[model samples]
Target: MRHARPLPTYLVQRYHGWKATAYHENKAWYRRLAKEGQHPRAMVISCCDSRVHVTSIFGADQGEFFIHRNIANLVPPHKPDGDLHGTSAALEYAVNVLKVAHIVVMGHSNCGGVKGCYDMCSGHAPELEEQASYVGRWMDLLRPGYERTAEIADPAERTRAMERQAVLVSLENLMTFPFVREAVEGEVMTLHGLWNDIGEGDLECYDPAKGDFVRV
Candidate 1:
């Protein structure tokens, strides 16, 4: 039989402290926010990494951004499955329901998904074929980019190439939805790509001018 485990003592204490602070110190903001609906101006597509906090990075207050997080923040080709597509659902809601003006797809350093695709494309991660998971299938979108970029000599270059490729793929996939395409072409909606590094606190933007991500 499995034994019952206790919650992390530190986490429990933090949770209680946060609850007390919210109830005592931040009640007004919470009450107003709770009564009103979110009217965010942007939707940010980001990874599920614990270190990458979108709110902290963007310096946004509550209800500023509608965030959609997946394994690698991939916007898959729109498929009408009669079921919910998590990322696509957020896009539809943000664009149609909320009418957000900007949609930002933020990629980052040391991305496990990009690294996984690089490994698979270079014949280093054969197990991807055996594991028929969503991540395995979703990450296949980067195959062409990884294959093309691996011809370079440096591993660092290949990783960077893969990272940028994922962002570009997401941007392209966003257009696969007819609504997104229409909104984008009509100039009512805009798309952006951003890169981040935790160690150096370096933020970069994908510059259309230079055709690369440079320091912001």
Candidate 2:
């Protein structure tokens, strides 16, 4: 702990600025939130891309959303084995403890994780195939999505399709959890899939009936 670096000056300055402005303006609200534990109505599983501003995009206030970000917004099939399952743990707490009414898996355009899966599956990235590669192992979840979009000839289109596939895959995997399935079956909770076009600032939501993403 002694070797830990001090906070960067610019970040420290920004924090102070936020404290003076936003925090000062909403002191009562912030205090109320601190006194009362969070009771978020939704849980959002999104990519760890800095460009994907989950709260900003949804115009959410603090403590309104319970968010979990991973490589490609993936949710692995429910496995009860004793392992360090970070995403699964978050999901369990969100569904059972928080009792969130909705779980949203939001993928985004040009995700590095999705692209890496494409490269590895296409035989372009051999390094990722190694057993010790943490990223490679994590991205293995996206392999099925790549396979589903393999028939597309255009590289860009294929990647785009795969991005949407990631959302679909997570939605399907969420149901694999017994708690999630029970909540959904009893109409206590719902699942949603979303894709964000970062460049265009466009949002798309999955339409289960049409089996495609529709512009939002």
Candidate 3:
């Protein structure tokens, strides 16, 4: 508590500006939203990368999407081992409570977390290999992805493939949850995988028919 301080001056100023303009203009909408509660259509699991703006990319308004962000946008395989699980909690809430129709796992280009997984799996990142490194342990989920892309000779292309695998792996892992699986099996829910090219502003979606990501 002693380390806590007031928000930064720039952020305070920006908040005030927003409050005076956007908030002022949308006061009724905000109040209605507060009263009605959220009923988002989809749950989006995306990277912690600052550049990957999920709401902006989808043109989503406030309360339109239930977003859960984590390193590499990963969803670990279901393990009800009586431990803390933030992403799983969110998924449970989104599916059981909110009952979102779609769950989208979105991966993006130049993801540092995916690159770290690649390096760690390749034995190039000793720090991540340590037992105490949280990131390394979490990224172990992507080891299968690294193995899938290891044969590619081009480093850049291999990294790109690894990034896509993040989305694919997460999509696969999502089905491990009984509730999610039941929902999908019952045709009430659908799973999607997306990859974004940040610089080019391009998006690709997984096409089950072709078994590859197609431009969107």
Candidate 4:
């Protein structure tokens, strides 16, 4: 707690502005939401990238979507060893408690985490290969994705493919959890994969039939 600092002046000013405007305008709605509690329709697992705004892309309002962001938006396969698993904990709550109807694993272009994984797996990033690197350990989750996309001749295209593979890998891993599998198999939940082109503002959704991402 001693390490924590007070809110920055600019952020405080921005918060005061929001409290004066948007919050004031929707005071009753906010109060109602507080009273009724949240019942989000979907759980969106997206990257920690600042450019990927899940709410803005879907035009969703407060409490409409449950969102969780991590590096590369990767989800490790189900492990019940009682270890610290933030993503799995979020998924458990979203599926069992919140009963979200859909789970979307969203990845984006120019993802630093994906790039790090690519570099590490390609033996180009020795620093990331160290045991002391937290980022390296986290990026290990995307090793499968890197392996899947390693053969592409074009570097740029290969990177993009790796990004999309992150989404695909997460979607696949989501099913590894028993709750997720039960929900999906019982027809109560659905899984989706998405890749966003940050520069062009284009969103592509994975099409099972086509075995590729189709622009939406």
Highest lDDT, which number? Answer: 3
Better of 1 and 3 by TM-score: 3
What TM-score, over all chains together, does every model reach? 0.89, 0.97, 0.98, 0.97
State the TM-score for model 3. 0.98
Question: What is the lDDT ranking, best to worst?
Answer: 3, 2, 4, 1
Q: Which pairs in model 3 have colliding backbones? A: none
Candidate 3 global lDDT: 0.94
How do the residues 78-127 of candidate 1 rate in per-residue lDDT, one tens digit apiece? 88883338788889999999999899998888889888877776778788
**Model 3 per-residue lDDT tens digits across residues 80-137:** 9934399999999999999999999999999999999988988899999998999998
Question: Considering lDDT, which of the candidate structures 3 and 4 is the better prediction for this target?
Answer: 3
Clashes of 2: 0
lDDT of each: 0.83, 0.93, 0.94, 0.91
- Whole-model lDDT for model 4 versus the true structure? 0.91
Q: What residue pairs clash in candidate 1, if any at all?
A: none
Count of backbone clashes, every candidate in sequence: 0, 0, 0, 0
Per-residue lDDT tens digits for candidate 4, residues 1-216, read: 899999999999999999999999999999999999999999999999898999999999999999999999999889989443999999999999999999999999999998888788888999999999888988888888777875797877888899999988888888889999999999999999999999999999999999999999
| lDDT per residue (tens digit) for residues 1-216 in model 2 | 789998999999999999999999999999999999899999999999999999999999999999999999999889889353999999999999999999999999999999888888899899999988888888888888988987899988898899999999889888999999999999999999999999999999999899899999
Clashing pairs in 2: none
In candidate 3, how many Å is residue 77 off? Answer: 0.7
